[model samples]
Target chain A: MPGKSADKKPSFSDTFSVVGGNFDDAGRVSSRIKGILKKMCLPFEVIRKAAICTFEAEMNIVCYAQRGDITLSVDEDRIVIEVVDQGEGIPDIDLAMQAGYSTSTAKIREMGFGAGMGLMNIDRYADDFDITSEVGKGTKLVMIVNITEGS
Target chain B: MELGFIVKNLKLMVRSGSENLTVDVNGGYVGDLLSDVIANSKQGDIWITRQIHQNIVAVATLKDLAGIILVDNNEPARETLEKAIREMVPVMVSELPCFETAGRIYQLIAAREK
Candidate 1:
């Protein structure tokens, strides 16, 4: 009898480093990850959720941090994404998570990002989400999305 | 209704991405708040907004929107037009006010469903 592992797709991983304040390439990393997910033949909805979360994370880095790293790891049934950044972290996590609360400067707002929904959007799109930060230090987010049941 | 049909009926100016005029139109949602649009809009929906920034292209692309209609004569910044074309999302404009254009779009799609 074949083992359960044999029935699962092989695992894959990718990492991208995003520069903060780089508005031009804010969504570049997410776009690349989306392309990879498309090749994996994941369902449309799943890919879309992943893209939104990744894009939001990337934009957060661009808006507030000095730089960040995004990692995509897929193992059979689930896809996990982790983003870690270095910058001025949120002072009040609860307030920041509110739908419309924003600390974005006028410059970022003019470009259509930093609406204060980055964390919420990412949380909503991911099946499991976690965030931790230290003021003037950095922020990190981990988002896990199920791929097996998606269609 | 098809995107081309909507464009013709509304007499909107196709500012860019003319080649994407054929994208199938499913519905329309009007909003300028970026995060709200991202959370509330549906796939293949035609987004009506006053935001003419390039980041609009990223939002629309992630949502797989059919096209974008900017109201109140809000012309997109040059980079916005470039990104819209690169993403294959037609960006159109209307001299009409935001509410009026949204109303017309609602009627167009509602009539099609009937």
Candidate 2:
């Protein structure tokens, strides 16, 4: 329940890279993100929501993309996460966002990811969410969660 | 409901984080899908799942769940157990399957709530 204070966190953007099929280390990025957010002494619900979004994004990269980077930053009133990944981009972004539809291979499913809830969970918790992708190219997500209520 | 009481009553294996045995269990949720738990589980709920991976701990911590009860006689990987301790999110296991574990936990929580 105790976390490092914000004074110890990186002031600006902090980026972490994800490699596809790295199930063993998939949660590391989000774990660090949660720690930094906690150190910043964000509200309990705010930290929890951000951590969920962060973990969902990391799992998406590990389950589908060949490689990706998650960049995190925070301002006075909000936190922003930018995720960019290179892999088999979603052919239908709309369908993909629907809960319970997943294109994950059997292999990925066996590891307990790829249930198709990642993107939706990310968007559900964020105050602002945008996703763009092209087939055979990559996907980019810019998600923002307001730190203070109704801000 | 304390995590220790459930572990003892169910005869589950204390795979990790014994120091956290006293965490209060407010209720219970049954799900294996990571997102389902992340999206639906309430804070302080005990999660019953077949998953025994490190991500299990990640979701539990993120949701602020009281602890995780792994069913189906599955054993968590060494790293999975290690992460439970590191995150201080207790993980326990029962030889029973997921549904049965949920049923029993439901009864326990129901009685406690009453």
Candidate 1 docking quality: incorrect, acceptable, medium or high: medium
Residue A141 lDDT in candidate 2:
93
Task: Enumerate the chain B TM-scores of all models.
Answer: 0.96, 0.94
Candidate 1 lDDT over residue span B17-99, tens digit each: 89988888878888887777877889899999998888788878777789889998999888888888777789999888988
Error of 1 at A127 (Å): 0.8
Worst 10 residues of 2 chain A by lDDT: A1-10
Segments of candidate 1 deviating more than 4 angstroms: A1-10
List of chain A TM-scores, every candidate: 0.91, 0.89
Which has the greatest DockQ?
A: 2
Candidate 2 lDDT over residue span B35-84, tens digit each: 88887899999989888878788888777788888898888888898888
Q: For model 1 chain B, where is the 10-residue window of minimal lDDT?
A: B31-40
Candidate 2 lDDT tens digits, A3-53: 533444535678999998888888788888988888988888888788888
